[model samples]
Target chain A: MNWNQIRTVYGKEMRDALRDRRTLLSMLLVPALVIPGIMFAFTAVSLKVVKKAAEETPAVMIIGPGNSEPLQKALAGSPKLRLVPAASDYAQQISDKRIRAAVEIPPGFEADLAANSIATVKIYTYEGEMKSSFAAGEIDRILREFREAAVTRKLGERGLNASFVRPFEIKRQNVAPPEKVGGNLFGGFVPYLLIILSVVGAMYPAIDLTAGEKERGTMETILCSPVGRVELVLGKFLTVLTISLSTVVTSITSMALSAVGLVHLFAGKVGAGAKAVNAATGQQLPMVDPVGVLGVMVMVLPLAVVFSALLFSVSLFAKSHKEAQTYASPILFLTILPAMAAMLPGVELNAKLALIPVLNVSLIGKEMVSGSFRYDMMALIFGSSCLYGAAALAVAVRLFNRESVLFRT
Target chain B: MIEAEGLTKVFRDKKRVEVRAVDGVSFRVEPGQIYGLLGANGAGKTTTLRLLATLLKPTSGAATVAGFDVVRQAHEVRKQVGFLAASTALYGRLTARETITYFGRLNGLGDPEIAVRTRRLTEELDMGEFIDRRTDKFSTGMKQKVSIARTLIHDPAVMIFDEPTLGLDVLAARTIVRFIRDCRERGKTVIYSTHVMSEVEKLCDVIGIVHGGRIRAEGTLDALRARFGQRDMEEIFVAAVGGESALARQDVPPATTR
Candidate 1:
């Protein structure tokens, strides 16, 4: 009951936990490195695939050979493209994945060009194939270029300069706050993913430290000492909370750095966002700030602390590592339903949402990533998280005090 | 003095069928005496011990530890009663001194008082060598000594050791036996439970033999022996249970009780 007792228990436990390497790795090392690494890798791989596929022109068979030469020339220069002779049964080949697409150019050939007519070319592709849409888009782009070339040629034939063939070019740009920019690039994912990571990061340690002590038959000794249940719970809860929040903060830093390709390790998970026009040498766009990065981290840390305490409470009931995990897995399922609420885009984080603990925090986290900030909402998250943390810790202490739970075997 | 008057404890389960763990147990031990409650597993020795320790509330009847009601004055009882159970292990992460100091504080001793008590208990229990060492490094006998130190830390007037030598090797057991005797010499009231007849004969000044949720016999070892008209205490124990052989069967761990 005394502060000294709480301090003693807390000090000893923290020292022991800090010395334990597995606790450190689970709570800090893994989250600080692995999560960001996985996210960056995912982002990088996806970005590469998208960019590569966007530039490629998969083989297209011009069925009618109506306007084949210029389209073939445009596709030939692209390495991602190939030109194949039309099969007698191109239909079967398309279904069998032999060719990416078959283009049906109307049979008019040169007549359509001389008539200044609106020509139509049909591009055939199987639905939902990798790079298939790219091939179709390339065909469309080719058709547009061909129309411009034909008009210019016709004007030249009449001795005009054909200046009207392409009078202007279209340019697109983005103006968003760095965090929002970060979010836009990898925004929705950061909040929810970090929340999960923070909670998950604390899971093993909380269980190992609190419940593990009981299973090992050491808690009674510890508790029978001058330490009261409240002090013991507080000390352990704070350790778990510290470790969990540290992981979140580290993830936030890693995600931010990786968002700009400053760290290649997690480039795939949170790749570079839209490049800004430098206007100096017309090089690649500048790596701007990511979208809604702050909000995601702010919201996820509380959730992480709540889950850490909760998992610790349950884990303490388990008698062994295997037994702890058995209960922990079900608890993991408990988290999933609440966490899934965050993935719902456009769901409002109302006052009701903040009262529900995990799901509410998740909703707040998602809202944060969307660059939405409410001071009251923030206070609710912090308050409720701490309250849940205290409650879960009380449950853990109750389990500690119960001889039946500790000696379940 | 300590007293349990017709104290009974019935552990209720989800099923309505009731199985009494302890029933109609009554006894008294004066200060400066070691009272042994001898019973095999499920004989309610532990339940009686728990009720006396204020850890479990008795279902019926009443008991008091050091003039404080076990249930209503649990905090007061805890303040005066020092409990050492086989189930309680020392904090491996803490030094023996730290462990004893902790319990002393819990018993409401001020900082200086706890420090004085910690030093005296550790020294008296022969824990001086490893009192500063973390419990994780202590040998089995050493841990038991530290556990004894923790129990005595508060300088409680009443001390209860429940199967305290359990899982302990002979050397550790001997140290505990000596410690119990030492408590008696110091004029402390002791409630020590064990089915170990040798321990009872050698250590208990007054003994209570329990069976089937009640005390079957209570007296001096010689008196108990004479009651059954047996020369050997083991025979007296066997004869006390008559033909049931319940005492012999209960030595098997509770897990084997099919």
Candidate 2:
């Protein structure tokens, strides 16, 4: 295969792809804007909605509170939950969502506390209801604080300090750097999206270059040229690879920019300041080192090639652009399986997992974004992916060279 | 200089049922001569041209284009042959000049050489008016001109035209007929295919009547007429294809009239 011939084919295909409005839309504009736009809308809208829902004064009904005036006073004193009059049909009300929650105190609530016996406080809430759950949580906290106050008061009456009962304290601290913490939390899905975007980006171009040529009647002309099949296929492959890589870069960059934009937009008003910025958006912001991100992009190359080759092979089997699309649709789901596998928890980048195709890339990519560069595993993943990519490319080249497949009516 | 020695192509569908699309078809065309393969649709005319152009491998026998073996030296064969189909299939997204230049470069011409050839072909094909415009909006004639220019950009020694004027208008078909004659004048061996008997009589220096994947008759127009005792090329073609039984229904007068 002559490299010059390959370059010629590559240049022409690139020109064609650039000129095709459909290709441009699917490959560049959609990836670059869609993810970030979805992220922005979800972040900006959900932040306001969740905040508004949380701040609403949810009314709670306290039952059997007359037996314990202190408990009733404790529930009423809390600012987060408003104490509503006890109702005979509070259970029905909670189920209907008219009331957030209901608290039922046992008949001997005060006597049990005085005798130093354990007393159980039952809280009823609409399960799976966000607002009701939040209210239930507040009521639980108020009862715990009330118990602590009672214990302290009794201890002080006995002329003892509260520390006597509580000998030690447990405090949790996150030792990971902010970048690593963010990477670990948010980097899990980056590999999945990268794999999906790389496949999607290469999809249209690969089909256009192969099946599109046949449909346009240009395939016969190209086949009649002096360039060998290997050269032609490789040229088309390179174009697809370029498109896939650019898409990965553009969409990832767009996502990062949108994250920064969202952080800046709602920083102070919604407590989306530094502390809550990452947590507020359901998706963790990817804050890994630039070098790590670069390394991850590099790691994505072989997988991109794999996707390009597979798409090329499948599309070439189709006789027309429309048929090629039909042939290629199932591959999207096939790719998503491995990508989604990488997103699953406990699927770490071990030696065994490195041998799997898309899943391995996802695992290593996740690690790279999380500020954990396991060179040994990275090498394994890269080398294996290259082998798989080459194998897939060889299949594509063989398909291109096949007379039966190419000239099928 | 093109030769086919019993070249054959067999196709097998998914059920493994074999159909011989081109069965032992053989013909030869000398330099500066236009050899026309005259056959009806589905008679393997396109398959024969494709075989000569190295687009398909012969299941048996061999063919050569400009003395390069279609099977073993397929790349060399492609280098010396320019194949055009009936569709006038130019890349719609590319300008006429861009399409010519792209094919020229693929055939190993450098940029400067491609530019020279592109300009010469454009002027020769009289496509200057729409040379720079994207071909998607081009008329049928304009697109055919672009396809012709693209085919000749590399100046190959053997040219293959598989019914190049099938869907063209009268003017477009006239342009292609003139182009085929010009190729002959330029000393390029041309293999043209069409079912139109008048086209064969007008242009072909030699005619090969192909039917059912085999050549049934081969000779110049006059020679075929003299051999078959038929003055008309259509009758000569009918006789060459199947003799009396196939033509008795179409060419013969009614028995009552006789």
Instruction: Tell me each candidate's RMSD, in Å, in order.
Output: 5.0, 4.6
CA-based DockQ, model 1: 0.37
**Which digits, one per residue and each the tens of the lDDT, describe model 1 over residues B1-258?**
799899987765445446576888899999999999887777778778777876666789999888989878766777787788787776676778776766676566778988887777766777778877888888899888888877887778999888888888988899989989989999999999997989999999898987877788889988987788877767777777654567656542231010
Span of ten consecutive residues with least summed lDDT in model 2 chain A: A277-286
What value does the lDDT take at residue A368 in candidate 1? 62
lDDT (tens digit, per residue) of candidate 2 on A213-316: 88887788788888888999999999999988888888888888887887788778545433464564333443666677778788888988888999999999
Winning candidate number (lDDT): 2
Candidate 1, residue B183: Cα displacement in angstroms equals 1.6
Q: For all candidates listed, what's the TM-score of chain B alone?
A: 0.93, 0.93
Residue A340 Cα positional deviation in candidate 1, in Å, after optimal superposition: 3.4
Q: What interface RMSD does each of the candidate structures achieve?
A: 4.5, 8.4
Cα error of candidate 1 at position A258, Å: 5.9
The DockQ of each candidate is 0.37, 0.46
